[model samples]
Target: MGFSRRVGPPIVSAAVATLVLTNFAMVLLAERASHDGHLFASIWPIALTSTVAVVLVMSFLFRSIVEMGAELERREAEAQHQALHDQLTGLANRALLEDRLEQALCRYRRSGEQLALLILDLDRFKQVNDTLGHTAGDDMVRIVAERLRALLRDSDTVARIGGDEFAIIQARPRGEADVRSLCERIIETVGEPYRLGEREARVGVSIGAVFAGPDIATATDLLRKADITMYRAKAAGRHCFRIFTEAMDADVQRRDQIETILRAELAAGGGPELHFQPVIGGDGKIASVEGLMRWDQAVVGPIAPAEIVPVAEECGLIEQLGYNLVRQACALARRFPDLSISINLSPVQFRTMDFPAVLRRLVEGEGVPCSQLELEVTEQLFIDHGPLCEPALQALREAGFRICLDDFGTGYSSLSCLRRFPVDKVKLDHSFVDLAARDQSIALIRAAVTLGHAMNMEVIAEGISCEAEEQIALEAGCDGLQGHLYARAMPADQLQAWLAEAGKARISDAA
Candidate 1:
C-alpha cells in the first residue's frame, strides 16, 4: 500500500525530470554538469516523504472521529432506554405504556375491535412498608412485577406506572371473562409470598378493568373508569377486580356531589337546617331541646342523617359541623334566655385535640351558660380514653357544662360509663324507652335509673310516648323524659309559644 509502482532509478520520471531541470539550470549558468547527484536525489526524497506524512495524519484523525461518534451514540441510547423503563423492575414505565396504548387504541379505533385497560394498585402497601421496611417492600414490588409479566401474553403490555401501582393493556380482550381471568391470574401471582433476604412478605392487589372499543373517546376517560373500578374493587375487598359499570359511575357521581355540597356548605357559612326536638319534662314543662341538623339541596333531596354524619366524620368535617351546630343552638338559647339546648357530639369530636378549648371559646363568646348548654355524647365516646377526651370532659364539667350520655345501653360498659364519665344525666336509648312497659324493658329501665341514682347522675328517659311509659319512667327514678307523649320537635316560634302557654298554666295553678 505504501507504493504501487516499480521504481527503476532514484526517482520516477517526474522526480527525475525535476532533477534534470535543476542540472540544466546549473549547465546554463556555466557550471559543471557534474553538479552534486546527492542534492538532486534529495529533492525527490523530500517530496515523497511529505506525501506519506499527510496520509498518516488523516488516517489517525478519521479513526478518532469514528470512536467519538460511537461513544456519543451509546450514551444517548442508554438515556432513551432508561426513560422508557422502570429502574427497579425493568418494566416499561407509564409513559411508554401510554404511548403504546395510544397506538393500539388508534389501531382498534380503525379496526372496530375491543380493547381493555386494567389498572392495579397494591392494597395496604403502606402497612407493608411500615411493618416490614422499604427494602422488603421494594423486593416485593419487583416480585410482583415479575409475576405479572409472567401471566401476560407477549402482545400485552404490563407496566409499573407508579409506586406500588401497576397497569396492563390487554389488546383485543376476548370479553369480560377474559378480563376477569387475567385479574384472577394477577391476584394469584401477586398473592404468593415473596422471599427477600430473610423476610417473607405478602401483599394483595386491587384491580380495575375497563372494557371499551373504538367508541372510547379519550385515554383520560379510560383511566378514570379503571380507577373508579379499582376503588370499587378495594371497597369490595382486596385481591380482587371489578368491571366498570354504570351503577358505579352513579355512585361516584353521588359521592362527588356530596363532597362538593359539603365543601360549599362549610365555606358559605352553612345552609344546614337546624331542627329542635322538644325534650319535655315529666310534668309537661318545656324542659329543653335537642338540636338536630338536616340538609336539603337543590338537586339532592332531604339528605339522610346516616349519609351526612359518616361522610362528615370521614372528611374531617364533623368537628366543624358539630361546632357550628353548637354555636347555632347557643344563639337560639340566647333568644329564650331560659331554654336549654343540647348538641350531639360525635366520637370524632371527643377524640380531637383542642376540641374542648374550641367548644368553650364558642360558648363563652356567645354568652351561653354551661348550664343551659348540654353536651350530648354517645355511649362509647370514651373508648381508649385518650387524653384528648379526658381533659375536655373534665374541663367542660368544671365550667358547669351539662354532660349527658346520648345513647345509653348501646355500647359495652354502659353501666360503668354512667359511673365513669362526668355526665350529669343519662338518656336511656330510644329503643329501650320506646317499649319500657314490657316486663323485661320495665325492669331494665328501673335498673338503669337505680344505676344512674347510685352514680349520682340524673336519668332522662327518651322515646317516651304513652302516659303509661311516662308513669313507669317516673317510678324508675328518671328525672326527665322526651317523646311525642309530651312534646314533639317543633319550630322555634312554636316552641316559644308552648313555653308561654306552660308559663300561663303554672301561674293559673299558683292562683
Candidate 2:
C-alpha cells in the first residue's frame, strides 16, 4: 500500500507529460512543413484538450491497476502466513519452526547464549479421539494450544509438528533452570482437564528438552535428540519431562539394532526361545508352568523380557512374536499332557477381533487341548481396552481356554475386575508376596483369595522366593504357588527331565 501511494502518482505524472510533449512536437512539425502558424495554434489547443481528457481517463485506470496490485500483494502475504502456520492451532508449522530454529542457531553461534528445544507428545489424547468424536479432539487441541500460548513468552516459538505432538523453541533461555521451569509448567498446564461441550476430557504430556550447546549445533540434531528424550519421558510413564542425554541416544541405537535383529529373526521363521517355570500346587506336585520368552542375541547379549516387548511392538512384530510363543507353549503341552501351560499375552494382541479365534486355531493345529492352555493377561488390558475385550475373552473361555488375570492387585478396581470379566484365575503380584508378613498385606491377600474362590476362580501366589513367603501365601489360602523357591525358568528339554525326576520322587514316596 505504501509503495503504491509513493510511486503511483509519479508514474502517472511522467506518462501525462510524455503525451503532452509528443502532441506539441507533432503540431510544431506540421506548422513548419506547411508554413501555417495559425493552423498550428488551432490544432494545439484541441490537441491539449484531448490530451487532458485522455490523462483523466488513463489516471483512473492506472489508479485501479495500482489498487489491484496492492490487493494481490496483500493476498500473497496472507497465503505465505497460512503456509507457515498450523491451520487448526494457528501456531507456527514445522517449516516455520525449523526456520526459526536455524536462525536461533546462527545467533547462538555468534553470542553463545543458550537456547532450548522441547518436544511434547500428548498422552491419552487418543482415548478422547476414539471415545468421543473428532470435534471433541479438535476442541481439546485448541484448548491445549491456547494454554501454551498463555504460558510462554511471545518470543518463544510453538509448533504443532504432528497430530497430538507439539514442539517449542525457547530462544535466549536464561539457563537450564529456565528450560526446566518452562517444561514443568507446560506439563502441569496441559495435564489439566478440558471441557468440550457437555463432556470432560483429560490428557497428559510427556516432554523432552534439549539445550543448545557444543554438542547440539544443528536444528536436525536438536530435534532428533529431543524426540528421543521425549520417548524416554513416555517410557518413564507420561506426565513427566526428561532432559537429553548421550546415554539416551545409545539406548535408542541399541533398540534399533535389536529391532533389526528381531525383524530378521521373525522373517526367517524364528523368534525368541521359550522357557518354562513350574507353578507348584498345594499337594507339592507340579500343577502348571508359565512360558517365558527369552532372547540371547550373540551381538547384543541377552535382552530382557521387558526390553523385548517394546522393541517388538515398535516394529509391528508383537502379534507374530506372541503367537510364536503360544505355538511353542502348545507343543510343550503335548510333552506334559496333564500340566497346564500358561502363556503371557500383550495388550496389543487383544486389539483385533480374531485374537481368540487365532489362538484356538494355532493350539488345535498343534494337536494340543485347549483346556490345558491358559492365557495370562494383565489388568492393564482391561483398563485400556475395557469392555471391548470381553467378546474375545468370552470366546476363549467358551472354547475351553482359561483366562487368568496376571499382576492382579497391582491395577485399579481389582474387585470390579473379578466381577466384570470371566477371569478363571488370579495371580497375586510379587509386590504383595514380598510384603506378606505385614498384617495389612495378609488381610488383602486373604480377602483376594476368598473373593476368587467365591467367584469359582483359582488364586495363585507368584514370586515366592523363600519358605516364609510360601507359608504366608498358603496361610492366605492361595491354591497355587510359583517362584524361584520351586524352580527358575528352564528350556523345554531340561523342564521335561525335571518333570520326570519329580514324578519318580513322588512314586518313591507313595511306595
Candidate 3:
C-alpha cells in the first residue's frame, strides 16, 4: 500500500520492528537448538537462510510502495496545474489572473512600484464565428493567446477572461510611456492575419489600460476602470488603446443617470410623446404622418432621438417603448381618418416570435384600421437578424399592415433589398436629399425613384429642408415628400391646427 507523509514514518518503524523481531526469533531458535545439542551448525544455517528470504520480500514491497506514492504525487501536481491554466491555450485563466493581480497590488503597496492592467477585446469577432465554423473560431482564439504570450514580457501575466476578451498585467513598468508602447505592440501583434483551415482571417483588438494609483484600491475597481476605458477606445475607433481617465467615469455616470430617468419615466407611463410629421403627396396634399418619438427631460431638456433611442435599445427598453409608440399612433390614426401614421420599429423588437401577434393585438384593441398603420424598418434589420426577423415581418405584412423600407438609399444593397422583400413604400434617405444638387447624386436619386415606381412601390423623398432640394425631389419623380420645409414634427393637437391652416392657404391660392 502507498503511504502518506503522516503514516509513512509509522509504517516504516513497524516494518523495521517486525524485521528485528524475526531476526531475534531466529537467533533464539538457534540458541535453543545449541542448548538442546541438536547440532548448532545446521540450525544456524537454516536461521540465516530464513532471515535472507524475509529481507528480500520486504525490500521489494517497500520499493513498490514508494513508487506508488510518487505516481500519486505526480498525478496530483498535474491536476493542480490544469486547474490554474487554460486547457486549450495553456495560458492563465481569470481565477489565476485575479490571484496574481491581488499579489501584484500588495507588492505595489509595499514597494511603490508601478503596475498596469490592460483589457483587450477583439473587434468583429462575432462575424468570424458566424461566417466560419466555431471550430475555426476556437483555433483563432488559441492563436491569439499564443501571440499574446509571445509578445509580453515574462514578468507580465496574460489571461483570457471571456470569449473574445483578453487581459494583461504588467508587474513592473518603467513609466506610462513604457506601458503605452507595450499596448501598441500588443495591438500590432494581435492584428496580424491568421490561417484557419483553408482560409485566412483578420481581426483587430481594442485595449483599455489602467495603472496602479491612489484611486484604485482593489482588483474589481482596477478591472472596472480598465473596461470603461476600453469601451472608450472602441468608441474612438477599433484597433487602438486608451488609458483610464476620470472623465470617462463622469461620462459613464451621466449615461447611467439618463438610463435611470428613462426607466422611471417608462414605469410611470410618462416617458415621451409621439409627434407627427406630415408626408405630402405629389398633388400637394397630406397623405400620411410619420410618428416621431420625442423626450424632454426636466434636467436635460430635449433629448434627441439619435441619443435616447440608442440608450433605450441598449437597456432593453426599446420593445416597450416601441409598443407604447404604436399604441399612441393607433389612437392618432383613429382621430385623423384621412391620414395614415408611420411608426419606426427597432430591430431589437423583432427578437421574439410573438412580436407580430402582440402588435396585431395592440392595433386591434385600439380600433385602428390596419390600412392606416404603417411600420417603418431600417435596412440593418435584414442585414443583422435576417432569419429571426423575416418571419415576423412577413406575418405583419400578411395581416394588412404596410411595411415601408426606411432610409432606402443609405445601404449598399438598396436595390437588391427591394427585390428580396415585399415592400409597399421606400423612403429616400436624407443623404440623397442633401446632395441632390450634384449631377451624380441627382442621377442616383432619379434612378432610385424610377426603380421604386417601376417596382410598383411609392417613393417618398425625406429631408427636404429647402426649396431647392424640394424642387429637385419633385423633378426626380418622387411620389411623396417629408421634411423640415413643410413642417417639423409636432404634437397631435399642433398637427391638427397646422393641417387646417395649410388647407386654407391652398384654397386661397386656388381662388
Candidate 4:
C-alpha cells in the first residue's frame, strides 16, 4: 500500500506531461503554417519554447516513473527476504526452509533431478557461549556462516534455521562430486577456529544429509529421514556429516517409541522401581550397595536402565529422577549402620548450584556418614567446566561423602587426570574385568591400581565373576569386587535377606 501511494505522484506527472506535449505539438504545427506579421512571429516563438519545455518534462517524467517502480519492487523483495531469513547469517529460517523444501520436492517429480538437503548443527556452541558470554557467541555464528557460504555454489542455498542450526539445499545434485564436494567443503570450512576477541573459539558442524528425487512423495518422510541422520551424526561423535539411511530412520523410530514409553512410565509413578548392587567391604562383607534404577514396561520385559536413564537426562527428567532415586537411596542408607549406600551422579546434576547443599542435608538429616555413602560418577564429567564440577564434589566431600570414579577406562582418563581429580575410589571398568587376562586387561588393571595407589585412592574391581577373575583382580591390587557371581542387584526390601546370607557365609568362612 505504501509503495502504491508513492507511485501515484510519478504516474500523474507522466500523464500530465504527455497531455502538455500533445498540445504543444499541435500549437507548433499551426505556427509553422502562419507566414507573416507580429502574430505569426510571436505565436511561433511561444510554440517553439512550449514544445521544448513539454519534451523535457515528458522525458524526465517517464524516467522517474520507471525508476521509482523498479526501486519499490526491489525494496519489497529485500523486505520479504529479511523476514524469512536469519538476521545474523542471512539464511532462510526453519519455516521458509520447510516451505521451499516442499516446493523443491514437487519440482523434482516433474524433472528427475535429485534434490538433497543437509541439516547442520554447530557443536559446542552452548559451551562456548557459557564460557565466553553471548557477544562472542554471536561473532562465532557470523564467522561460521561466512565460512559455510564460501563452501557453497551459486545454485545451492544455505540457511540458518535454528540458534546454531543450519540448512543447506541443493536443487539438483545429480553428480556424486557435487554432493561429496559440497559436504567436504562445508566440513573443512566449519572445522576452522574463528578468532572471536582473542579466544580462538572453534565451532564444529555436524551435518545430516538426505536425498529425495522422484521416490519420496511426502515432505514429512523426507524431513524425518534427514532428522534421523542428523541424530546419527550427533551420536556418531559430532564434527561430521552422515547420509540418510533406512536403518537410521528405523533406529530413530524405535528410540522415539522408547522415549514415549519412558515418559509414560514416569507419569504412571515411575514404574518397576529401583534395585541395589552391593559394594562389598575390604574384608569381603556386605558393605554398601550402589543404587541402580530399572524399568519393566507392561509390554516390554525388563527395559535396560542405561537406555531409559539417558532418555530421562535428555528430556530434563534427570533432575526429577535423580532427586527421587537419591531420596530412596538415602532412606535405605539410613537403615544399614555398618553399610554405606552409593548413588550414581549424572553430569547435569554436577552442574546444578544447590546440589551440594541438598546432598549435605539428605545425609545429615538421615544421620548417615557421608563418607560411607560413595558417589559413583563417570569419567566423562571432567570434560566440562571446572567450576561446574567443583561445588558439587567439594560439598559432598566436605560433608564426609567419598566420590568414586565409576567406569574408569571408558572416557578421557589420563594419569594426570587421575591425580588432579579429587577421588576416594576407582571402579575398574567391567570391560577389563570381564576379559581379565586375554586382552592385556590385567595389565590395564595393574596400571590403574598403580595410579590409584599413587593417588591414595581405594581401588575397586567391578563385575569380578569367577574365582580366577577375583583372584586376578586381587593380585592386581583390587580392594573390593562386585558382579553377578558375587550377588545380583536386588530391591531394598530384599536387601535384608541378601545381607543375612552374606553375613552367614562370612561367619562360616571365618570359622
Please give each candidate's TM-score.
0.70, 0.87, 0.80, 0.77
| Candidate 2 structure quality by residue, lDDT tens digits, 1-511 | 4567777788888888989898989898879877748888778888989899989987897889789779878998899999999999999999999999999988888888668999999999899999998999998998899999998888898999999999999878887889899998998899888999998889999999988877776799999999999999998989999999899999989889889989999889886989999888767777789999998888789999998998888788999899889889988988888889999999888888898888889889999989999999998888989867988899999999999999988999788889899999999998876552567667878998988999999999999887778777887889888888778899999999888877334311311
Q: How well is each residue in 122-173 modelled by candidate 4, as lDDT tens digits?
A: 8899989999999999888888888877777787778887789888888788
Give a tens-digit lDDT track for model 3, residues 1-511.
3345446556766876787687667777777868765666666676667767766776676666677777888888889888888887888888898899888888888888789999999998998899998899999999999999888888999998889899999878988998899999988998999999999999999999999887778888888999999999999989999999899988788778888988998899878789999888877877789999898889878888887777889899988888888888988888887788899998888887899999998898899877789999988988877788778888999888999999997777787779887789999987886553566666778999889888999999998887778777877889988888888999999988988878334211311
Residue-by-residue lDDT tens digits, candidate 1, 179-267: 98999988888888778788777788999998775446777777788889998899897889899987988877887778779878888
Query: What is the descending TM-score order?
Result: 2, 3, 4, 1
The Cα error of candidate 1 at residue 92, in Å, is 3.2
Give the C-alpha lDDT of model 1: 0.77
Q: lDDT rank, highest first? A: 2, 3, 1, 4
* Selected candidate, larger TM-score, 2 vs 3: 2
lDDT of each: 0.77, 0.87, 0.85, 0.76
Better of 1 and 4 by TM-score: 4
RMSD after CA superposition, every candidate: 9.3, 3.5, 4.9, 6.0
Q: What is the Cα-based lDDT of residue 383 in candidate 2?
A: 91
Q: How many backbone clashes does candidate 4 have?
A: 2
Candidate 4 displacement at residue 237 in angstroms: 2.5
In candidate 1, which residue pairs get closer than 3 Å at backbone N, Cα or C atoms, i.e. clash? none
